[model samples]
Target: MKKGIRRFGGYKFCFVAAVLAGIAFVIPAAWAEDGVTDSEVVIGQCAALEGPAAGLGTGMNVGMKACLDEVNAKGGVNGRKIKFIASNDGYEPDKTVDCTLNMIENEKVFALAGYVGTPTAKAALPIVQEMKVPLVGLYTGAGLLRNPVSRYIINIRASYDDETEALVERIVSDLGIKDIAVFYQDDSFGLAGLSGTEKALKKRGLKLAGMGTFARNTEAVKGGLASIMAAKPGAVVMVGPYKPIAAFVKEAKAAGFNPVLATISFVGTENLIKESGDAANGIIISQVVPSPDDTSIPVVRDFQAALKKSFPNEAPSYGRLEGYVTARVLATALEKAGAALTREGLIDAIESMSNADIGGMSVSFSKDNHQGLNKVYMTQVGGGKAKPVAKVARP
Candidate 1:
């Protein structure tokens, strides 16, 4: 009888241990999906934080953190605070891939946000797809990110195609200028803008008067300048970051080859102005967001307040404002996803935002459409400041 009782007790103990072990395995799997925890969600950013394009990345990070901090201060979304981690890629494609891999494999981020450049974003896309991680609000409007619409990538700004269309329209219609030329970086980002320009000009029964190219992350605009100068275009559509574009503008002005200079929104306006000094004056720039100085817009007002609260010394900028807007859109989707957050749930929530009003901006998404805002605004540099251009005229 004693031997039989001991055997029964041992059997029961083994069964209970097995059950507890199974529960232990299931609990972690249920809670730790990607970077989610009971009280926090982790998001990562890989951008040019320490190079010539550092302004773009740092501004975006500041804006995103400001908005996230505001959300967390208000008790977070669905009782979970967002913990953002940013890594620098120096706007290099190879570094971007490495940073993205680390973020997903090591840091285990829930999603990626505020990526800086087109080339960088292009490099990270394959990894994003393979890992099934969502990338929201990248800072490029390249057609590749929008066309065919990857389930893992979300864009918040108007496409380069859209911005270039607006620019070409104004260059031809408002300015009544023809014989347009292009000065672009010799890379994915510049090529995307060049393609957009070609498409827009083709619609108007016109072709590029001249074309010139420069390598990425370097200010080698002399060769490109000479090529475009020879064409003597009435208006030149410059494509690249602020530093290179600024260098080109200054060199062109110094050489007395000034034409009506115009650029897409990717050329950070304030930084361009600073880099080119007075040379930036009379230059036209397409803007994806409203003038950061325009506080009349409800979203602008909120962005300004949030920025001041979080980054006390920082001033308003288009790049930072875009980051703020992207964060707001992402937060809205998180709220819609509810407490049981998963990667698919977050993506579904983002798609469900159809004509959704984020403060004053209208963002829309669907299963077939992932690009959010399509509106483009025009601005011009004058007196070292970028002001809204209500009317376009030949300079």
Candidate 2:
């Protein structure tokens, strides 16, 4: 899969813990492959800060450190100043290969941002392609890291074949329903949402009325609620994380085996409605980004007035607004990678962002696409919260 490291696989780091909560300060290595200087630049993450997907690694490190503290309070990006660092691979892939080789051979970090899981990013995908670095904003779409397209992995969101083709077009044309089933999470991010809902149900000629699994950070969802309630499928979907799909939707509605569950936005939406309280209400998720309470979209109203003036009551979510639009698309590819940054000029300035508009949704990447955003919104789960799904399909 593109040169070596098998594109994305293999994990064998023996020990290496201690980073999250300890924060980072290490800057020893000066043979900088490109985390720059003349101010700062270093980046790093290695997610899952302490177990059962610590709320998707502290809501993607509090939205990538509150958008890198609002781009170092506006004096950064292009002028540098980014440091970051984080580590705790509690989502574990051999401790995310020793926290990506101690943040690229000992805190040298030039790039790699907002990482979450997909078997802890397939063990840091052969160490970010043998130290070439530049893995921005990845939270896992897992087609072996956007299908062999690892120039340094910059994927934004939307994939799992664009959230299972917008969740099979609103579960077969606005919930008309098709005996769907699939409980997932046995690996590779629930077999890539069970191969994107079996290729969006074989493009509608339909399929998959049953399939189940579990085993990842285990709550051991009773054999996926006895193989999706012995194929009683009227709709199931769920694919992993969020404490085994909120313990397989609270043991499939206390063994009554309800349906129309649906999921994926890599689960964890408010940790599956605060751990399936009312069995996470009506379920159904599938966003890429946008609608952290819409906020009329101006970058989710500047991510809800800077996350309520920096966490003062922090609530706007969708995992910290997709980590504040992946740190505003990594500060717009390090301010278009000028100021002489490297790591292949921030992966050619995020593959020369073609669609670019980061205020009300729009992000692109090229060199034949690194999947910045294919779109896909769709949300649900009433009173317990998590809105959105009205006209849906935003991409």
Candidate 3:
């Protein structure tokens, strides 16, 4: 009887030990990493997916998904498929905050990517900082995102200062136009562009010939147009979304007030053409990404192929091409991070890149610098399309 009791006690002890061992092993696996699993990595985006600026957000999302889908088809990055979650903020700052919070806190995204506008980015930046989430490839060139260089934020495009400086140089050198005015949305985005234009003009010992402002997300540009018209400036630098800018252009043209109209890359080229019709012709636009139709460049060719394979019916645009480049860069960083897949590891991998060539475009990042791709291409709208231009001439 004592022998039987000893055998039973030994069995119970072994069972308890086995259970404890199993729990110990499961704990580490359960808490391996946030937004990362054995099979997948999750990314998030908050942008104006619907509204006047919907074209920018939707185009970017489509491009990113296309790249990610292609990567997944080819066994993914280091054996993990990327899952992208996009939330719409309608280009509104308040909605951007909500979308960003929901993505970080609820969706548990590993990183944020392809965010659209300057005001929206400003709104969500505090949350990103507080949560210490890495935000990659914002579309805005606002200096606020690039100035202090937060460790958690990464920019894949040129700055507004860069674009503005290029515009000023071309306008002054090629067109010999010194009487320049600004028509901009009255928000952080507009102010950022305004500041950039101001700095660029000041470098040449010049100032704005005139300035006009309109409310954000609205087509109420008549008053601003009147203000700009009153100044009778030779060239006008416009900073706003497609809708208001289109309205301003149509109204100004109707009033027979035609001058050199130039805008930054943030203005969706295709959408602006669609909205402005013939009025868009001869308008100058600065582009951060090469023309999607320019398949000569290796990266542009790859983007075209990926876009065609993934989205057969969708046409490529600068916004979508930018998105594709952003995803490719992020994917390269993710692959460099290896299978460990931690946020910090990913950041380190990105910072380690030195003039890394992703297809054709050269992108570089470091501990001191987070902005990549300083080159800006200039395009002119003609025959309902924006094409690369060597110089800016009078309309």
Candidate 4:
């Protein structure tokens, strides 16, 4: 009887010790090192949180925060909490590279997510490729990020080609405007958008009526606007950032060129409506995501609720949608990456996903193709709101 009691006690003690060991194994490691083990997963982002495009940075930052916070509240991903360390690059390529390198080297983040800008994000591609870190959902329209086959980067939004082509098609088919002109920034972004516009026009047996290119950070777009206006095109398409877009519109309006305006997804028509006052009326632009003003859409409603609950003081904006989608994609990849969460595992998991849908829009990815959202939405400014006219188009 004594021997049997001792045996039973020993068995119970061993079982309790094994259970404790199992709990320790399941707990993820904190963000003290590069890879997140069985406590937290650290993701890094280098966004334009300050500088000229601070509004965009703020929106995206808020979206990412809302998403990660929600995830943390819900017990995190794979029994590990997500910690995002987002830095402001001030829209400078040098600063972007520095911040990204620091995140990878010092912060020891598992992957790079929601990086902002074309020039800045492009600058860090070499290092990301060299280090083999998963560069997912870069916030840029430059085709090179997903094209010409870079192994590291994945794009969350549609390319400029998709938006530009859709706008050009509408100009030719729907609006029936023959003499079209283009005002583009004189960089990779400008060239890529112009290329798409040219291709679309060429299909309709039409050519550019006039063209003007401006350097980045130069508000002297009046000269370009004048050049485009001189052709007296029935329609004009602009490919530039918000500051330049606003400057062009204001200058063009001042010059009395009231031709129908069409632009890529980055036009920020709502913000422009507020800034330009009455001048923004009747301006049409493309959108890859749902409009904030449209509360009927389920995704927009959910997003609004998320924004309202998480960030009450701030209003939901376009860039915030970008960041929200960015977080969603990363979360999907992390969920699918399984228990052994490494950078390589994440890359493989994301690359394997095809036709991945996040609420309203759908994204596709493959081993050879990294461009996620290839669909574009065409929207027009009417009655003090951006109204989506047509369904999404994929290229």
Per-model TM values vs. the true structure? 0.93, 0.34, 0.92, 0.87
- Per-residue lDDT tens digits of candidate 1, residues 1-395? 22322332456758856876777666664274779998999999999999999988998899899899989999999999999999999999989988988898789899999999999999888778756799999999999998889999999999999999999999899878878999999999999999999999999999989999999999999999999988889999999999999999989999998689999988888888899998999999999999888988999998999999999999999989999998999988988989999888999999999989988889999998999999999998778888898777665
Query: Candidate 2, residues 1-395: lDDT per residue as tens digits?
Result: 23234333334221122332243345433233545677888888888888788888888888878878877888987676888889788887887777787787778788878888788887777778765677887887878888778788888887777887787778778767878988887888888889888998888889998988978888888977897788898887888878888888888788787778878887878878988888787787887886787667798888777777678667878988898889889988888878767688778878988888989678878976788888787888777887886643221
- Give RMSD (Å) of candidate 1 vs. truth: 9.6
Rank candidates by TM-score, best first.
1, 3, 4, 2
- Whose TM-score is greatest here? 1
> What is candidate 4's TM-score against the reference?
0.87
Model 3 worst lDDT run, 10 consecutive residues: 1-10
RMSD of each: 9.6, 16.9, 10.5, 12.2
Please give the lDDT score for candidate 2: 0.79
lDDT of 1 at 126: 75
- Per residue, candidate 3 scores C-alpha lDDT tens digits across 120-213 of 9998787777567899999999999988988889999999999999998989999999999999999999999999999999999999999999
Candidate lDDT scores, in order, read: 0.89, 0.79, 0.90, 0.76
**lDDT-based ranking, best first?**
3, 1, 2, 4
Model 4 misplaced stretches (Cα beyond 4 Å): 1-35, 293-297, 391-395
